[model samples]
Target: MSTQVLSPPVAAVRLEQVTKRYGSGPAAVTALRGIDLALPRGAFTAVMGPSGSGKSTFLHCAAGLDQPTSGSVWLGDTDISRLKPRALTVFRRDHVGFVFQAYNLLPALSVEQNITLPLLLAGRGADPGWLDFVTGAVGLADLRGRRPSELSGGQQQRVAIARALVTRPDAVFADEPTGALDSRTGRQVLELLRRTAEELGQTVVMVTHDPIAASYADRVLFLADGAFVGHLDRPSAQQVADHMTHLGEW
Candidate 1:
């Protein structure tokens, strides 16, 4: 008998020569300049760039919120760049998670209801045990019945995080998730996000301008003039700030 080693799993997210452009001809504005990236599962990565660096465009393209003008994007083994609009919408609902600065929650829904909304939209019944686990993971076990209006900003954001995790999505994309919180609360949220990646084996990709927020990630990738310029591993806030200073003005 012959023994063979199995290959490792595909990247949680991969982008190959991805580019984006708005308009055409002389008036065209190119956002991404052939970005290539691969992020593994159970990793926390942060993206930082100065103003007009294509950070938002990169996130949108990677998250399937917008199509790339060229190249390919893969979510695990699926070529999401080729999916049609409706199929892409369904795929994103079932496979991808999002956390935004605004804490986009439904006012009429309870915390638990909001968290399970993705599963509802997917027409899949929430597993009670899994639901319980996700709520507990985000420290919302006791506040499951509260409405969004009844919660504090931090609590509401926690609900959003729990909601993002409920689908057990392949990757969670966070756009300035701590932007609206005070320093102390923002620290708490960042810690929770790190824990989600470390303890749950989830892949997290965050885009932010704050050095302190970016420092929470395992690695910080820098962008400039629409391309990935460099990266730092396990960087400190001061290091990130100094690098940004060198990258030029915000």
Candidate 2:
């Protein structure tokens, strides 16, 4: 296999001419159309698009949760898209964390247990300092003993965030993390996600439909029909809304 040389600046996450198609020939539905992206270290980026615009596909491919049909995905020095299944699994377990629209916590597990699930699954125990820091950062220190059933929607999402950060991942992929919560709680979760990127020097790529949520990111990348068409830095909520609206209307 020919080696692909990655860039020297060391982006925490990136995609180069990546594409994904659901079928072959005339039946094929191209989800992504040879897109490129670079997510800098310690930055928070939001991905915005309407439904079926490949927002989720991009995030999944970047996170190694799914493979692209062609091109490359680089995580730090490694081309995660090229790793074999076991290696990819290890890389994702060791370096990548993810947040989804659903809390997806084990209902039987307490907040603390749920937070440590990934680590435990990898045959590692929790680190007290990381546990303390993430839980405290998410303002869930007192709720560790509580189960998912007992927490509010926002609180559960905070637990999910804590779980994602417990391993100090190189980067995180979050898809509609605040979608399941109300506006007030959603803002709180977004703030915590922002803090995670800023204070911890972690990279984050989030897919969000809400411009308010997108505004929390340091940069916003807008997509239409599975391509990277535009970007904005330090975008305001209004700016994000305007850009997304124009993309939809285009």
Best by TM-score: 1
Instruction: Give one digit per residue, the lDDT tens place, for model 2 in 158-231.
Output: 88888888888889889899998999999999999999999988898999999999999999998889898899
lDDT of 1 by residue, 1-250 (tens): 9999999879999999999999999999999999999999999999999989999999999999999999999999999999999999999998899998999999999999999999998899999999999999989999999999999899999999999999999999999999999999999999999999999999999999999999999999999989998899999999999999887642
How far does residue 93 in candidate 1 sit from its true spot (Å)?
Answer: 0.3
| Per-model TM values vs. the true structure | 0.97, 0.94
The superposed Cα distance between candidate 2 and the true structure at residue 7, in angstroms, equals: 9.2
Clashing pairs in 2: none
lDDT of 2: 0.91
